[model samples]
Target: MEIYETQEENAWIFRIDGRLDSNTAPELETTVFRAIENGARRMVIDFEALAYISSAGLRVILKTAKDLKRLDGKLVLCAMQDYVREVFEISGFDTFLPIAPTAGDALRQVAPPKE
Candidate 1:
């Protein structure tokens, strides 16, 4: 998978393209870990271009969420296709992970509070 990351005013946004499987999950994990180590607290993942996700991908996402929670941070996932959403639902991830229908909605979910 190809990941394009950007620092927004409120959160770190990652737009993923292609499949997120065993081969690509490691890369995503590394990128996310590096960002968190650098003090990123809020994150939004856009899956609009992502074609497929394997259990390995789910593991990476779960780990990232757990790490962020330990740091008192937040994560939002959005733009998932129907099949992807089904996968999350089947995995019971929908119970805990925050999912939005659009990236804008995801961003709002993780947006920094106004001063």
Candidate 2:
């Protein structure tokens, strides 16, 4: 899988392309962890181009979310295809994790508050 990072105001957007299985999950985990280390608090993971996701991918996401919570940060997921959305639903992640219909929506969900 290919992960693309973009900065939108105070939020960081990570777009995932292709399949996220055991092999690619580590890469994603590392990338996200590095971002967190770099002080990325508001994040959005875009799954528009993602074709598939395995359990490993789910674990990475859950871990990221938990870490973000501890830091008082936020993570939003967006642009998921039907199959990908189904996986999240079946995994029961959809209940706690926020899923938006588009990247813009996700960004808005995690956007910094106005001063």
Candidate 3:
């Protein structure tokens, strides 16, 4: 999977493309960890170009969300296709995480207050 990082005001956006599976989960995990290290608390994982996700990918996202939540940060997902969305639902992630229909919506939902 390819991860594109960008700054939207105070939030960080990660636009992922391709399949995030066992072979690529570690990459994604590391990328997210680096973002956290760089002081990014509000994150949006944009799945507009992502085709598939395995359990390993889910684990990475789950870990990130938990860690962020502990710090009073937020994590949101956007633009998921049907297969990916189904996997999340079947895995019970839907109940644990908040997903938005578009990247803009996700970003807005979790955007930090303006100074």
TM-scores for every predicted model: 0.96, 0.97, 0.96
> Which portions of model 2 miss their true places by more than 4 Å?
none
By lDDT rank, best first, the candidates go: 2, 1, 3
- Between candidates 2 and 3, the one scoring higher on TM-score is 2
In candidate 2, what are the lDDT values of residues 1-115, reduced to their tens digit? 8999998887999999999999999999999999999999999999999999989999999999999989999999999999999999999999999999999889888987779
Q: Which digits, one per residue and each the tens of the lDDT, describe model 3 over residues 18-112?
A: 99999999999999998899899999999999999989999999999999999899999999999999999999999989999999899898897
lDDT of each: 0.94, 0.95, 0.94
Candidate 3's error at 33, in angstroms? 0.3
Residue 4 displacement in candidate 1 (angstroms):
0.3
RMSD values, in order shown: 1.0, 0.8, 1.2
**Model 1, residue pairs in steric clash:** none
**Cα miss at 46, model 1 (Å)?**
0.4
Candidate order, TM-score descending: 2, 1, 3
Which numbered prediction scores highest in TM-score against the true structure?
Answer: 2
